[model samples]
Target: MAKKKYDYSPNDFVVYPAHGVGKVVSIETQEIAGFELEMFVIAFEKDKMTLRVPTNKAEEVGMRSLASTDVVADCMKTLRGKAKVKKAMWSRRAQEYEQKINSGDLIAIAEVVRDLHRADDQREQSYSERQLYEAALERLTREFAAVGNGNELEAGTEITDTLQSRVSAA
Candidate 1:
């Protein structure tokens, strides 16, 4: 097999499309079916879960380095934009929101956050809506924390504050 082009070192924060931000704990070589495979051992701190992804398959699986500062800034700006909630049925919207969260695209996740965010004066969210919102928020905040030199809770609060401020200013 050809070598993978990406260079992810131990301790590097990487985004796995389905999982969000995880740290590379180590790289290990293992023998499976007589083939030696190199794997990346990634730890998701919040989930307390670890995953081993084949190094050669990283790119194919959508594993990527943390978003650049410019991309992160753009995502933050996306959060400040007006919510673009569709008039579709709740089931369809829920599926779309789940897709955006799993896409690991920072700005797309921010769009989910913006659309689902509830202001203090607004009505309470449906349970499903609350679940999707929190999932998107957690995914976005994990990436934010990875790039913002802060913890997840801190980044989450920062994003929440920004969202609330934007809502009030509008």
Candidate 2:
């Protein structure tokens, strides 16, 4: 038997670039086209989606373990920083934000949330802006929760608290 390229085991939390976070439900080997293909069966409970990614292609597809404590701390620091909203067109900026959210990079996702965040006193976000902000927030929250071994709501509250504090301090 060939050794697995990745060390992901069942029930491990992993981030798939385009899909945020998912749990490795199982490692499966399925016969396909006269070859045995080993794959990771990942489940995104929140999205109600299950995805099978080839084990050998996990790295190629940007699948990785959850962020470390230091990375999470850096992400929080990113949230505390100023929002760097570009003066580009809405469509262009929206596309960029979407790409960042889907990149599965914790810091990039934090930047999207920070850039699109609207405080209570600030002008309201447009429909599209709200959508992108919510998506980024959700992705960040889920990973944060997984990293802390906490619930999503708690993680989300902590994240928002950090953002709100930054706003109040500025």
**Candidate maximizing lDDT:** 2
Q: Give lDDT tens digits, candidate 2, residues 49-148.
A: 9999999899998999999999999999999999998899999999999999888899999999999999999998899999999999999999999999
Question: For all candidates, what are the clash counts?
Answer: 0, 0
Task: List TM-score per model, in order.
Answer: 0.93, 0.96
Candidate 2 segments whose C-alpha is farther than 4 A from its true place: 1-5
What tens digits encode model 1's per-residue C-alpha lDDT throughout 1-170? 78554479999999999999999999999999999999999999889999999999999898999999999889889999999999999999999999999998888999999999999899999999999999999989888988988687889888999899999998
Task: Estimate candidate 2's RMSD in Å.
Answer: 1.2
Q: CA RMSD for every model?
A: 2.2, 1.2
Clashing pairs in 1: none
**Reference-based lDDT, residue 161, model 1:** 92
On a 0 to 100 scale, what is the lDDT of residue 69 in model 2?
A: 96
